[model samples]
Target: MTDDSSRAFVPGHVTGFFSVHEADDPEQAGSRGAGLTLSEGVTVEVEPAVETSMQLNDEPAAIEAVTRVLGDLGVEARVTATTDLPIGAGFGVSGAAALGTALAANRTFDCGRSENELVTIAHTAEVEAGTGLGDVVAQARGGVPIRLDPGAPEYGRMDGVPARSRVEYLTLGERSTEEVLAGNTDRLSEVGVDMLVRLVEKPTLPTLLASSRKFAREADLLTPGVEDVLEDVADEGGEAAMAMLGETIFALGNGLTRAGYDAEACEVHPTGATLEMD
Candidate 1:
């Protein structure tokens, strides 16, 4: 029962700190972290086709997460995704694409899967692809998500920062998520565990930022550019830290601008992924 077409939008997510968890089951392999959902993100379109194909921003490409979703759902379709955020910049672009594709494909193929099932499929695909850990769950719930436990939508537990504020970011360059995820992560994981515990106890944006700064320093994830930007922000009485696995910096309110950066700005999106009905 193929439909005419389908579309979905998923918010980009920026994780401040996280600890890795792995399992034989992909659904159970996720990270415990805190992150914010962005007002800007990816929009995906699905159309029935003879063979499964995909394009990102009109360029023919192969995204592991998207391919995994299509294979899992057993559907052949043309998937197109467009986003303003730079790929591999810690904005969860791959996770967003996977979630968007899953949501759109489910409708296009008339699959009777529930929302939980869709999230599970996407989360598993992201984990298997090594593109992300907690992004799927955070994007699934939106807002400032605090992932307290690791897993898929069904297995993972989450809470969020209650207050919303404008978020600003500066993208210095791309960092391969897969490469970082594959490397030694002992120190980073330890710092992430500590930060997650602190956040769960307090559950506030200020705590998230403060913990992020410490994690960046303790985990040694901060690049020269990120460190310089962070210092500048601190001098200006603003809080800033490196986005996980990317040469990017994110801060609260107008922190980036106040630090003399021409950064991109967006609000804290209150919702997660959604199918565009109209």
Candidate 2:
């Protein structure tokens, strides 16, 4: 008989971040971003096995993270993961999957790794794969998390907004985070840092939405589809902003749905990933 462990985590929408790298200290290299965790998320199931195998909703990039953690523990397992959100649309699906997998596999194999260690593994995998930057850490500590300092949990700092509200989003299409990050991000990082500072000084839902939109414009990340949704949201007297690293438009209210966009509505997830055994 084999015991299975399952873990689920909410997806986050990064408003902005300043990506930094410390080659000598991988743990100190990451982004400082602010975003909220949505109710939609990824779930991973793991059980002991003779050899490691993974099924990740056809997400190839996630395999490395799972395999790396399992290999480090010298624990073979069969891992399966699923998610409700679209990948590469800035919903942080990859980060959620990686974090959830780490948590589930750890418990499934009775590995005594601490939470911070698991988070570091997942964060490093995301960074190396270019799938995400600070999503893993933010997802580890849910709500409207502000990655005040860069890097994995062990070497990073985080804060968040306590007020929760309904969040609505529309998936426009996919954008490759790797491609975007590879480009010159001087202006983007500068604007992101400014926005982060402003938001931290006054952490509120309205401030987050406003700063997110400001970041999009300053970073030149808005696409035609995203612009259209934002316009529609505005006409309806609501605010909307593009999710970082993707083409999705996340609104603060249900205005997008009323404006004829198929917006998915969910509350802000107030906590991090969770694991259960059966």
Candidate 3:
């Protein structure tokens, strides 16, 4: 028998997803922003962690997603993680965990699925989990992601997205994704969706981010100290914005370093997941 077992750490993302564009129109979530990584990837390893207990609301969805991958690869495994950030906090925890599980399963079973393939699996898991939309794409291809249209799942990866940008996140306790969204129907606007469509189609994220940030403010999702922090980042010569659900805010700018912001006051995490090979 083959020794199939590996570990992968999927990073967490910020809030800011209104809706996925439907067949007839664009989708958007203007009242949110996601930021910072907590140095903890959604770690998934091989070796069948056995009868693990998951504390998430959608245990069935998460379990089913992992089980399907295991069945496809003919392997066994166990998984666990913290459920600190509630769903709809604008943090891409669900997507990150699903991505981590997929990668970990592949490594554990030697399934040989590509990055894109893993993204597809993660996306399916998100839909099943009912956490949010476009999470798979956000977790897989991060850094100011702009998905212009919906239904087709076509996204553009903008190079130099962080060329003149720096992102920071603040953990303002915890909030429910559903509650935030319930209170944030006004943030999603038609013009913003159209602009997102244009930006994604042309693949201009940095420029479009400026407008996106503005729309976020109009939607009343910006958290306390967010505008102040953004101003500080702007003073240092960069563009700043709040992320998914006001859970965190990121400041993007040219020559912006970690020193420019108060990292001690916030949770800082890199963009992306990690891999653990046994």
Ranking by TM-score: 1, 2, 3
Whole-structure CA lDDT of model 3: 0.51
lDDT of each residue in 1-278, candidate 3, tens digit only: 12555656665565343443322221222112222344333555445555533334335335444555455455556655444454444567766766777777777656788876666666655554345556556555545444443321333232213422344444545555545444535436444564455454554435555655665676665666667666766677665556655455554433124426543222334355656656
Model 2, runs deviating above 4 Å: 6-23, 58-62
- In model 2, the worst 10-residue window by lDDT is 13-22
Clashing pairs in 2: none
Top-lDDT structure, candidate number = 1
Q: Candidate 1: lDDT over CA atoms?
A: 0.90
Clash count for each candidate, listed in order shown = 0, 0, 34
Rate residue 121 of model 3 by lDDT: 63
98-146, model 1: which lDDT tens digit per residue? 9999999999898889999999999999999889998988998989999
Per-candidate alpha-carbon RMSD to the true structure: 1.6, 2.2, 6.2
